[model samples]
Target: MRIAVVGTGYVGLVTGTCFAETGNTVTCVDIDQKKVDKLKGGTITIYEPGLDHLFLRNLKESRLHFTTNLAEGIKGAQIIFLALPTPPGEDGSADLSYVLGVSGQLGKILEAYAVIVDKSTVPVGTADKVRDAIGKNAKVEFDVVSNPEFLREGVAVDDFMKPDRVVIGTSSERAKALMQQLYAPFVRQGNPIVYMDERSAELTKYAANAFLAAKITFMNEIARMCERLDADVDMVRRGIGGDERIGKRFLFPGIGYGGSCFPKDVQALFKSAEDVDYDFRILRSVMEVNQEQKTYLVPKIKRYFGDLKGKHIALWGLAFKPNTDDIREAPALYIIEALLKEGARVTAFDPEAMENVKRVVGDKITFADNQYDALNGADALVIATEWSAFRTPDFEAMEGKLNKKVIFDGRNVFEGPQMKALGYYYESIGRRPVKP
Candidate 1:
């Protein structure tokens, strides 16, 4: 199978590389000359684990390639994947200009029948819009299939190759058969390849992300209640998670959800509802609750020092989540902005996000060399992202590094009593306060 993937972003690159790994010839097309050149040179543009190896190997084998010219790249491909960006508009609805604009271009140049798959996350009815956009000038038959990706940033390659389930939304039997055949190798583990209408398929991606966001928001609300009532959110999470209905996955109450999926999807769902003259009340509440959760540690920080002015705070993490460097809508951003406005000085550390942050938020705060260095002369340590390294650190080292033994843990990375025994003032979400 010959596949051409447009956009060459996270999803596009991963999708093209993985498809090439599975014995398909893939040409990834990007409009950015620099990015296409980088891909062509075998240098990875993203930080997805296990993707570089496959990408490099596939490129070496001549099964995978990259180009800036869309017509040249997608020339003879049987399947063309539009894994483009459908970023949120000002109104929170997904802006379909990228998808539609490319669809229009595809309509002009396509000389034969092709299966145009919408691998990007788009709003409902986008498949029809794309189909119509292309159909206007298309001389040959083409099917627009809404096959949304459910890949996580860190483990995108594995997710793409061995998804839990594959959803295809096309009424055309010919398109369905080609898609099924293309994905057959992946679902050998018996994961169902569910077929549905295009609209349902588009909504499924949004619904999944929104549900996960709602789940995280609900847990954060519980954490807030626990803080007021002297209950342990960890224990409460465990107690409820033990139930068959509430299986434990995202039960931990963190500083809200962020990155590429949850926030955008939740807002898109809300916007989609508004488009139809309906108010998605639950989703609206979910968004409000999540915004508070992101900056949930502000009050705790202020209470710790009485006054944030002239305070030196050590921030342990800055990325949205662990195992990935994405910081879009990161809780740490909200926390840092609040701290700065309160006249506090901040020193932050992350395993991989520091350089990226430096580009966008240079000199906002000092960029620490490492976790221990971040604590140097700081009043307290605030745990933002739940990075694995932050779970266990040298307690004595932390005590020695900081000017004072105070910790505000938003991710609840430590045991309350353990921190107290270590002679530090530790504050965490819905847990017993650790007093030094």
Candidate 2:
């Protein structure tokens, strides 16, 4: 199949590259001339694990192409994918200007029958809006399909290459057949290609992300209760996770869930419920709990020092999670802002996210070359993101750099007994503090 993907953002780029890897000719369209130029030069703009190899290979093999002109890109293509952004508005509803605007343009230039797939995480009924917008000026027939992506940031390549299930929302038999054929290679392991109505398909994407967000938020609340009741959350998490129903994934307690999807999708779903005169009370609480969880360690740090004035804190991680450089809605940003407001200076280090953080907060905080370099002259150490390197460290080196052996671990990176034996004052979520 020949496919044209509009909007070369993270989702669009990955979708186009992965499709091209499976023997489809793909041309990606983006309005950003510089980005298109970079991609044309065989440079990938996003940092996703295992994406670069496939991207370079596909580009070299002439299966993947990049262009700034949408008409040129979509010409002779059987499928057009709208992978544009649906960023949240001030009122929390999705801004559909990008998706609908392109739909209008596609109406003018479309020459033949094609399947237009909505590959972004959009609100319910967006496919209807898209179809109506395109039908206004289009003379040729085209089928608009709602096909949302469920790719996690770190493992998007794998998720695309081997999806658990492929959801295709189209009423037209012609459109459905094309989608089924396009995704047949990926679902060869017998994972289903679920066919549903457009509204249900659009809602499915939001529901999946919102449920995951709520699950993580529930565990965070459990961690809070464990702290107040003198119980260990690790043990509680392990106890509940062993049950087949509860499962182990997304059960680990941390600052909160943050990324491109969860925060935006949860808020959008809550607002969508309001549009229909329904107040989703659980989603409301999930939002509140996650906000507090992001800064849950602030009060503990303040109580320990009485005043944080002139305190130099070493922060071990900045990315929201591990293996990706994305810092959108990252809890580290919230923590850094709170610390700076209290007159505490911070030196931070993350293997990949430092450059991104530096762009957002220029000269506000010092960036370190390495994790240990961040500890030099710091009063204490704080772990925000659970990067692999922070799991085990040389205690002697950490002690030598810090002014005192005091640690505030937000991710619960260290064990309770080990910190006690090391003779350091270590505090962690839902665990007994170790005193020097």
Candidate 3:
């Protein structure tokens, strides 16, 4: 198979590299010359786990290539994947300019019959719009298919290599057959390649992300109730997670859900509902609650210290989650902005996300070389992202660096009993505080 993937972002890069890994010839196209140059020079741009090896191997083996020219990139490709961005617009609807603009361009250049796949997460009617865009200038026959990606940030490579189920949206029998052949190697484990209408396939991606966001918000609400009623959320989570009805995943109560997918998808779904004159009440509440939950720790910090004007705080973790250096809508950014507004100085650390945070908030908060370095002369230590290294730390080393033995943990990294035994002031979500 000869394939061309446009817009070499996270999803595009992973899709191209993984497809090439399955012995298909893939040429990835990007508008940015510098990014294309970087990919050509053997540097994998994104920080996905296990992606580097595959990317490098495929590149070295001559199975993968990069180019800035879209026309040249898709010269002989059988399938063209549009993995472009659909960032939320001012009105909270997905801005489809990038996807539509590229689709229009692809129309003028395509020479043969090819399958055009919408690999980006888009709205329900985007496929029809794309088909119209291409049909305007295309002289040859081509099929536009909606095939939204379901890859998670950290484990995208594995997700692509071994998808549990591949949902493909196309009405054309010829297009469906080509897609089935292209994805046959990936679904050898009997994972069904579910075929549906284009609109349903488009809605599936939004629905999945919205539901996960709601689930996380619901647990955060439960965590709030647990705190007020003097109950432990951990116990409640475990008790309910055991039931098959409520899965264990996405049940951990945290500050909130923040990433490229969940926040944008939830908002887009809500906007899509409004466009259809339908009120999505639960999604509306989920958005409201998630915004409040992101800064859920600010009030606690203020109550603990009467004046935050001169407080020095240590914060651990900056990424939205672990194993990836993505900081889009990260909860730590919300906390840092709130703390800075209160005139408090913060020093923060994350194994992989600090550089990204530095780009967004330059010198607003000091960046520490290590987690303990962040605690030097700090009034309290606040854990934000729950990075693997922050899970277990040398408490003695942490104690020696802080001005006071106090900790405010957002990810609930430590238990009340352990903090009590350690003789430190510790506060966590939905758990009893331990006072020194």
Candidate 4:
């Protein structure tokens, strides 16, 4: 298979590299000359685990290539993937300018029949719009297929290589056959390739994300009630997670759900509902609850110390989740802003996301070299992202590094009983506060 993936962002890069790993010759196209040059020079641009080896191996084997020129990149390609950005617009709808603009360009230059795949997450009816855009000037036959990606950031490579289910939307038999053949290797383990109409496929992506967002928000809401009722959320989580119907995933309560997917997808889905005069009340509540949940720990932190003026706080974790350097809508940023507003100084550390955060929060707060270093001279410690490294730390070293043995655990990384035994004051979500 000859694959051309447009837009070398996180999805595009991963898609292009992973396809090339399966013995397919993939040419990735990007408008940015700098990014293309970096990838061409054997430098992997993203921080996906287990991707570097695959990318380098495929590149070394001459199966993967990168180019800034769209026409050149798509030449001799059997499948063209439009992995362009569909960022949420001011009206909360997905801005399809990038996807449509490239589709229009692809129409003019396609020399042969190709299956154009929409790998980017977009609203329903986007495939029809894309087909219309291409049909306006296309001299060659092509099929526009909606093939939304379901790759989680931390384990994107694994998700792509061994997807639970592959959703491909196309009514055309020829396009479906090609797509099926292309993805046959991935679904050999009996994982289905669900074929449906374009609109349903588009909605599937939004629906899955919205449901997960709601699940996380529901747990956070339960955590909120647990805090008032003096119930342990961890026990509740374990109690209910054992049930087969509810399942175990997305039950852990935290500050909130924030990343590239949930926030944007939920807002877009809500906006889509509004366009059809439908009142998605549950989704509306999810949005409201998640927004409040992002700064859920701020009030608790303030309650612990009545006057936060001149208080130095050390924060651990900045990424929305662990194992990736993405900080699109991380709770740590909201916490930092709220703390700064209360006249509290903050020093934070994340294994991979500090540089990205530094770009957004330039010189606003200090970024520590390490987790322990972040505690130096800090009044209290706040755990924002649950990175595996922050799970277990030398409490004696942390206690010695901090000005006070006080901790605010937003991710509930530590237990109340253990903190009490260690003679440290600890606060966590949906759990009894440990006071020493």
lDDT of 4 at 243: 100
After TM-score superposition, the amount by which residue 44's alpha carbon in candidate 1 deviates from its true location, in angstroms, is: 0.5
Show the colliding residue pairs in model 3. Answer: none
Q: Tens-digit lDDT track for model 2 on 270-342?
A: 9999999999999999999999888888889999999999999999999888989999999999999999999
- The per-model lDDT (C-alpha) reads 0.91, 0.95, 0.94, 0.95
Worst 10 residues of 1 by lDDT: 427-436
Clashes of each: 0, 0, 0, 0
Position 29, candidate 1: lDDT: 92
Candidate 3 local lDDT, 345-421, one digit each (tens): 99999999999999999988999999989999999988889888998899999889999999989999988888899
Off by over 4 Å in 4: none
For candidate 4, the C-alpha RMSD (Å) to the true structure equals 0.7
Q: Compose the digit string of candidate 4's lDDT tens values, residues 61-141.
A: 999999989999999999999999999999899999999999999999999999999999999999999999999999999
Candidate 4, lDDT over the whole model? 0.95
TM-score of 3: 0.99
Give candidate 2 regions above 4 Å deviation: none
Q: Write model 1 residue lDDT over 195-303, tens digit each, in one string.
A: 9999999999999999988888889989889989988899999999999898998899978998988999999999999999999999999999999888888898898
